[model samples]
Target: MKDKYDVVVVGAGPAGSITAMYAARGGCSVLLMEKDRDIGMPVRCGEAVGKDGLNGVIEIRPEWIAATINRFRLVAPDGAVVEPDIGGTGYVLERRVFDYDLAMAAVEAGADVVTKAYVNGLWKESVNGQERIVGVTYTWKGIPRKVRGAVIVGADGVESRVGKWAGIDTTTDFRDMECCAQMTLAGVHMEENACEFHFGSRWAPQGYLWVFPKRHGMVNVGVGISGMAAKTRKPMYILEEFIKERFPRAGVLTTVAGGVPCVDTLREIVKNNVVLVGDAARQVNPVSGGGIAGAMQAGKIAGEVIAGAVASGDMAELEDYPRRWEKLRGARNRTYYRMKKAVFNLSDETLNSIASSVLKLPREKQTIWGVFRTALVKRPSLILEMARTFGLKERE
Candidate 1:
């Protein structure tokens, strides 16, 4: 690996790879490093990406998709189901293939890529008597090494040490941190190409349970419980119990356990010559817990901004990265965070009431806002938050 580059990005996930791709395309020497032995090994996500959002970041490839989801169901505590009148809007991805190709895209765009490189800390030096981040210290194959860069972008996961080292407040509130467990279950015979969200104390107390269909009959069954609720019973135990009750006959293929930081965007994402993207910057959608699109979007923005700043020799341009992110994606995440705060605290009875009310809507009125309206009826104070969250306008 080179000792120096114009842009040094840590992590080979969607955010880092995309950042390296765009930076290299913008005429910067970029290095994309992955801590894992291989990129996209041991997938951790629920693997659902919105159709338009994913397309906006990268051209959608058929091989990247595992299943086309055309239907969405919100299940209530009392077995009530509310179906939204949504068109084809989602896809469950084959992330193993998808992430590898994206990193390859970055390499094709002229970024150097490496694997099994673990970044330990940020290295800074005095420039004009002011300390500024200049590089990173990491180990490759157990050999210590450091790389210098004009800019360092941290695309690490939710527990981002780089961000913490850079002095960004990456701390998540106890309630905002979601403890999750997921399993790939086979021999399940429910609806195909349909994603279901199950809600209730029996499923996931403050968080929710999801059944996302994969390419085969295997379904991604998972449960996310709020940190507050996790204090009582662990997420894996809840998931195991739910599996026994819901899909008792299904065979378990794989299991994953992790934490998702559900906080909105950090107050600061860019500092000096150091930057944070993806989950490191808390870009995951609070309500849905999806981040592929948001990470790519942030990566692109950060890459362009850092490249422009380097090209112009004005480090001040780096600040534009966070502003653009806020305008393009962070504001939306903030709205979802507020919505999560409201919806996550609802009792099972309230959820059932909302679900029952939503199921009674006319076929034409069965939309996201339709369900929000039903929720607003029970909790009247959610009108403004709901309006902002759903982008609802004045009555026609």
Candidate 2:
């Protein structure tokens, strides 16, 4: 749209939109681009986000929410159920409306927004014998256009090429990747205020299956399996079998498929004039594969950092983006990664045995804390990994 701007954000997802909003609020010309013709089209997420996860970042709007969850049940392979005291902490969102509203907020804050803009390459400017990311070349409406900027934020999804172009390693271990498939179905009988998660190798191989209520009779049923297992078992067939067994009468209204990077955050999120946020930075939770909240949080940090750098007339200030983010949540994220890797390595029978032990406890002991404590009793060596999961030192 313009020859140049102070900041050009690629991918107008939550991370990109939030980055644009904050950067513009901090006194910078920002342009947000989306490859899709409409923002939030073809929703690929399970759409369940916890209330505490989004507390300070975004005020929950009534319209953006489809269903509110008060509790959740964790079902083991033997059908042993453990209900966690979540206390109405989660909500299923209408992502199409939610994402559009987020981008609109960015526009209202003085950032330019464009859809159907596909970024094919980055614009590099060399200085002192080093090439730096300066801008991007994108196709808008079947026409090639070039836009230059002092800073570029790659808010693109998991298959992001921006970071790769900037020489940042965005590689993920296949075992750390979750191949996911989701379906929005109607005529399902389920607890309206509770989400259900089923676990076991039979249920989802190395991952899990979730049934999040969208409304009273509608639900988002999904499964996430390890990418390594996906090589042998097709995700769609697995999902179909699970659905048929659980909800034979359910009619599928919509189906979506995607991949979630269930690994620690990328070590380097910013390089020179370029920054990566959200999935591009692998900010999804290693344990749950949840990323909406983390993406927004990282976007907020990246926006402020980029804006501060622009105001200070120092390009080097962008390097602090990842540092500030890690200080805020990355440290805990790394811990989760460690725990995820350890638990993921556990045999399915081991997990089921652990679940059975927890289920035998009283209703009061069915909490996540209780489950972990029970697990520690069986495998004392996992204590350190569990400590790391909570950001606690092993010595403590």
Candidate 3:
């Protein structure tokens, strides 16, 4: 194996694989590394992704998908349900197979992939009294090896060490983190074409529960709660209780528990020749905590920027990657973050009142945004205040 490469991507998740694919295809020598023995073992995500968000990035194969979705059901506090017809609801993916396939795409694009490689820390070189990233030192198969590259991308999941090693503030406050727990269950009766979401303080204060149907008469049933709420009640206990009561007849297939960053996108995701993408960049949506699409979008932009910088012999151009991601996701994140705060702070009575108002709306107008707007309509003063504070425009 070569001792060095033009680009080294840490982590083999969606972000890293996509970045490696684009970089290698653009004529840059790339090395993609994964700490785990497998690409997507021990699945962590809700495994749901929007179809529109993934278009043009990669083609979705039938084998990679468990089921296709066309509708969504939002269950509010007091068990009031709102069914909305929407396009591009997305698919429940078989993440283990899907992730491996993505890494294979990178390899096919001319990048080399190494698994069971753990990066201990970054390798730095001083040029003109300026500390610059030159490579990374990692242990692969119990043997220490060092690989150098012109650029390093951190696509390591939510708990990323590369970003911190590169001097980026990757700390996420408990108030801004969602404690998540999920289980794949069989023999569950659910709408295979419709994804279900249960919301409310009691159900998951500051977060929600999701039912994403998959193949073989199974679905991924999960709950994500704010860390603050988790302190009072363990997330696993909550999920277990919900399953016992709500899904009495279902049999568990697999269990997964982890945390998702709910903070708004970071202001700085780039420095020197290093760049952060995916969870390392805090690019997940604040409201939904959904990151698959956001990661792919950022990866594409990062690849373009990195390629340009490598070709120009000017590393400063890499800064544009973070700026571009901010431009694409910052506004929506800011809005959703503020909205999440306000929504979580609402009292049970207030939520029930909002639900009642939503029930009054015509069935055709009972969309998610419509219901949210209706709930906030009565509190015009608060709405204007939130808009001003969050720098959001008042949308009717």
Pitting candidate 2 against candidate 3, the one with the higher lDDT is: 2
The lDDT, on a scale of 0 to 1, for candidate 3 is 0.86
By summed lDDT, the worst window of 10 consecutive residues in model 3 runs over 378-387
Model 2, stretches more than 4 Å misplaced?
Answer: 126-130, 384-396
For model 3 the TM-score comes to 0.95
For model 3, residues 1-396, the per-residue Cα lDDT tens digits are 578888899999999999999888888899999999989888888889888778878898888888888878878788777777776568889998999999999999999999999998899989899888899999998899899989999998898889889888899999889999999999987778889998777677778989889987899989999888998987788889989998998999899998999878877788777888898888888888898988888888888888888888899899888777778876788778877777666666666677778778898888878777877885666586677667676677
Angstrom error at residue 205, model 3: 1.2
lDDT by residue for model 1 (112-216), tens: 999999999888888899887889999999899899999989899887888889888888898888899999899888777789999889889889899999866
For residue 149, give model 3's deviation from the true position in Å: 1.2
By summed lDDT, the worst window of 10 consecutive residues in model 2 runs over 387-396
Instruction: Give Cα distance to truth, residue 281, candidate 3, Å.
Output: 0.2
What clash pairs does model 2 have? none
If candidate 1 were superposed on the true structure by all CA atoms, what would the RMSD be?
Answer: 3.4
Model 3 pairs whose backbones collide: none
Better of 1 and 3 by lDDT: 1
Ranking of candidates on lDDT, top first = 1, 2, 3
Tell me the TM-score of each prediction against the true structure.
0.94, 0.94, 0.95
> Where in model 1 is the C-alpha error above 4 Å?
381-396
Candidate 3 wrong stretches, greater than 4 Å: 378-385, 391-396
Query: Per-model C-alpha lDDT, please?
Result: 0.88, 0.88, 0.86
